[model samples]
Target: MNAIADEAIYSFGIDIGGTFTDVILHRGSDGQSISTKVLTTHLDPREGAIIGVRQLLEQWPIPPRQVGRVVHATTLFTNALIERKGVPTALVTTAGFADSLEIGTERKFDLYDINIEKPAPLVPRELRFEVEERLNARGEVVTALSQETLAAVVARLVEQRIESVAVVFLHSYLNPVHERLAAEYIRKHAPGVHVTTSYDVAPEIREYERTSTTTACAFVKPLAEGYLRGLQNNLRELNIGAPMFLMLSNGGLTHLEEVLKNPIQMLESGPAAGALSSAFFGKLDGYPDLLGFDMGGTTAKLCLVEQGAPMLAYAFEAGRTKRFMEGSGLPIKISTVELIEIGAGGGSIARANSLGLLNVGPDSAGSEPGPVCYGRGGDQPTVTDANLQLGYLNPDFFAGGSMQIDAPLAGHAIGRLADQLGLSLVKAASGIHILVSEAMASAARVHIAEHGRDPRHYSLLLTGGGGPVHGYCVGRKLGVKRLICPPSPGVASAWGLLVAPVKIDRVRTLQTTVQDGDLQAVEQSFLELEQEARGVVQESAVQHQKTFVKRLAEGRYKGQGFSLIVPVPDAALGNEQGRQALIEAFENEYRRKFSRAPSNLKIELVAIRLSVHTEDLIEEGLQFPSRSGALAAVKQVRKAWFEETGGYVDTTVYNRDLLGSGDTFNGPALVEDAGSTLVVGPNATCSVTAHGSIIIELH
Candidate 1:
């Protein structure tokens, strides 16, 4: 294939997930988009991504030179930490703080459990070395860094063949001079070793969180560098001369260099992109406030989107021993889209527990073996197998007929679990399906309630490979009346990467009372943060594109250990009016959360944050293309099981591509698309929107 017209340009978005690699292409000449999905290559994720990209471009026949931009998001770093596949790393901390990771805030996620297991530290004790350096809370040096001790630590690290090191000095967020000096010495002596400092990764007051965040960055630094550079080189070799932008956990995009420095920032990159995609499609479909339900092969994630933006969180846990427990995972302080994730997906393993109760999963078969229906050597019963057994999935139409699925194999796999549970095949399959739906609904309820939102008020927008398949039952459980399945729901995350803005978030610790404090210093600190954030954004921003900045402050009452984030006033904070505005904002937010504010308590500002991002590049109200033919919508009829219908009933199956705008259909129908399938329950009214989205309305 030859290159398109020189004037026309194209952009590619690639998302490497746990089970699949999604690649999407968008043309600048027209609002055309296409996507493809391939099984993830667990050995080297880059290989799967490259293959998907090559296949997409070949199918669409777009030349490489015309590709102007490449945006990517991946779960590689997160998986590395979870699987302990990262290189050997070391930690250098101030004296007497070597056990900080072991003694993490002295808080237990489950207090009543006699034997609670905590996430282990990435670096073992032998790999953790301490140096003689100290700084007080006021940023004053208490004990100077011992040069001989630091040199010896560096020598020990080199001797141990540590490829990466995390240097976290006490109070380094306030005074990083000692940490910087140690890093400089290490780089000079062992130039091959990578160094990460707490101040650079997470400059906050919490000792344990800062150290954990830095250690995570260091642990994945070498692996991230190699994979990213190799992917870039391979793209160039394909004659695609575009600059690649990486997706950040905070629902933004950054340059390769920025993420290589702190790979932890990409920990939630894939899920964040999925959330952003939901928000983007929801707004276009006239539902700005909705809940994003993304159920891929490995897990299900739910995020709250309000006013066309998904909520942002400052910190999130990674590699949790307990999926829903907060402190059961490593605490990493990085900005990310707020969401709750549960282990309920198509590939989630299903089995009878010791108590003779059926349990779905926190474990998935992934794409390597996949579900039994894929004929990938999988012997375990999974949600996909159960769905197939229930007639919810068309074996021949799986993955748009790109791959053949064996229905008998799926039934045989589920038959074992059915026998153990002493239930019929159909009954057992229904149990598995309902169990996963209930789990997702339970998690979503808590997540929404935590944000003081009512599930009935928010429309549920479903995406990912499994979302549409299970969305109806999940939404019904949550008492949600409406659900939306956007076009190409399976590869939405890749499309999200293309629309994400170039963003940078910066923070600084500034302890001060709203009533009496150094206002000038606070203002100066914000200015500095904004300047730094904007500089980073410019590295990835388009030439001459306008940028926007949002100022936020983390504040708390006088004696509180936790803080809440509130928007800071746009006016100058050096004046009394600005201070009053800040206080009012904090109080307003407090009232919303707690229903009232204390009358006689002082407000303390813990930190200030600045976020800079380029303006949205995609136009609003853009609609996806519809089918060009007048072909009949109903492709076939299949006997499908539905609780509402009691037993197997002949259900009309419709091809999603043939359903044009305003096409209306009733329940007990299956809308089949190339990427995913949407199941409409009995009595529910399904309609096609102008943009090719399937909207199911249930009373």
Candidate 2:
């Protein structure tokens, strides 16, 4: 293998998930990513990444030297926070605000509960130290930061053996001088300790969440940087000399240098890939509003895509003790690709509850000791066991038979669960599948409703290792009519990396009111935002690109504590009429959200946002000859359980690679591939597309 050249080309996109590492290779000439998957090496995720890349290279007969850019998405940051595996860290704040994490928003989400525990602070109270400093909301400093107090805090941190420190001062979002000075003083005294500032990292309102976000950034900075550096070195050693780009939770890519400073931005990186895939493929299916459904080994993720773009969120909570409960986790405000996740995947463990009713997971038998069917020393019953016992899986053909599964183990696990629940083995397996499907449907419903949407109105784009197997049941429960399972669905997320546009979102808080007639202030904010966003995109190293800007204001009627986001005109700040038009747009959006506009209420603006984008849009889906025949005529048949039918049905099974366009088949079918499976049940019809995808229409 030699280093890749400018003229030659294979590009790679790698997604390192909890259970698997998927690799997609693009042929330089066609720019089509070839996909494949490998079991994750939890001990060293990079090992699986390399193996997956090598496997794809071998199959395609492409030299390593031909490979160009490598886009990567990893769960390292998320895992570190979840497992508490990052380096020793401490927090420094204003004299009176040292307990920001402890004295959070102060509003209990579960107000009626007698005992509701809040999420534990990431940095312990003992390690939190404060310096005498105060900054007003308008960037005015009342008490200057003192060097003597900073030195004492550094001395104590050294004594406590803290390797990383985060500084967050009161109202620092408006004036960062105190936080920056404190960081410099600490760096001078504790030369080896990493220093992070809330002003530099988050610079937002909400003292507790801002501090937590900065602390988390510092907490995982060292670990993520080391891992990324190692991965880059390994790629260089393999002669794949393309610059590596990391996927952000916001569905954008950033260079390794930028990612190292803010690893928390990559929290939802892996799941974002799947959402991108759904959005990209759904467009080709003539569906602009699609609900992405991804069910893998450990969890089921749902994301909404409207007009071929996935929704974005500015606030996210991670490491929740209670999965669906708000305020059960630490809040970190940043631009994130919106998604809803549940514990309802193939490896989700199933067990009997105290009430004697069977329940499916929020817990999973992950990769190492996977489903009992994997014959990997796992004894617990999981969704995989239910699928296998119900004959949804072909024992020897799972993962293209890369690892043989033990049917006896699957049967035993399901049977044991059945015995405890006083049900037949078949009934218990079907029950598990239904329970999991309902859980998924319910989660999607809540997520969609939160955005004031109806699930039944959107088309479902299903992908992942387990999505196809349960998509129909989940869709049925949600009352969704159509399900689209694209080709190579298992590696769909990796493919998504190829289609994502270079995007940058910039936001700054600018509290003002239209009544104030301070248009220059708004203009200045947009100017600053534009410069900042352009700087980030330039840092990404994508050259010779055009920039498009979308100006938006977070506005609300007077007296409202929070603001609703409204898009403003790009030309608004330049003239008076443009400002009037922008205000009208705001009112229109407000009316849409609230269903009416208050006649006499004043309006206030809280924040201004600008997003820049550059994309090489390509036509989707290559047309191929359609196959005309019953799907069963071209593939094998297997038995799969149907909850609605209350019995097993003989289901036609086809290999995704072999299915061609225009091939149609009725429900009670399974489509198999190396990476995943698609299960179509009774009352459904599946038709193959020219690009080798399956469109399942539900009745």
Query: Which number leads on lDDT?
Result: 1
Report the lDDT tens digits of candidate 2 across residue range 1-699: 212233435668899877778898877566465677787888888889989887887788866766667889988789898788888889998898878888888878787887988888888889889888888889899888977888898999988889888898998887788887888888888888988888777877778889989988888988887889999888888778777888888887777777777788888998988898898888876788999999888889999999998998888998887788898898987888999998778889999999999989888888888899888889999998888888787878788778788999789989999999999999899899899999999999999999999988988988888898888889999999899998788888887776666667777777777655587788888888888877877766345555577777877888987778877865656577767777788889878887988878767887777887656323332233444445434467766778777777777777666666677878778778888878888889888766666888898
As for candidate 1, its clashing pairs are none
- How do the residues 1-699 of candidate 1 rate in per-residue lDDT, one tens digit apiece? 111123337889999988888998888777788788889999989999999889888888877988878899999999899888888989999999999999999998999988999999999999999999889999999999999999999889888889999999998888889989989999999889999999999999999999999999999999999999999998998999788889999999988888888889999999999999999889888999999999999989999999999999999888998887889999999999999988788899999999888999979999989999899999999999988887778888887787889989889989999999998988889999999999999999999988888999999999998999899999999999899999899898987897788899998998999889887899999889988888888778777778999999999999999999999988789999998999899999999988999989999989999899986555442347766432487889888888787789988898888888888888888888878889888969988888878889996
Off by over 4 Å in 2: 1-8, 616-633
**Count of backbone clashes for each model?**
0, 0
Model 2, clash count? 0
TM-score of every candidate relative to the true structure: 0.97, 0.95
Q: Give, for candidate 2, the lowest lDDT window spanning 10 residues.
A: 616-625
CA-lDDT, candidates in order? 0.89, 0.81
Model 2, residue pairs in steric clash? none
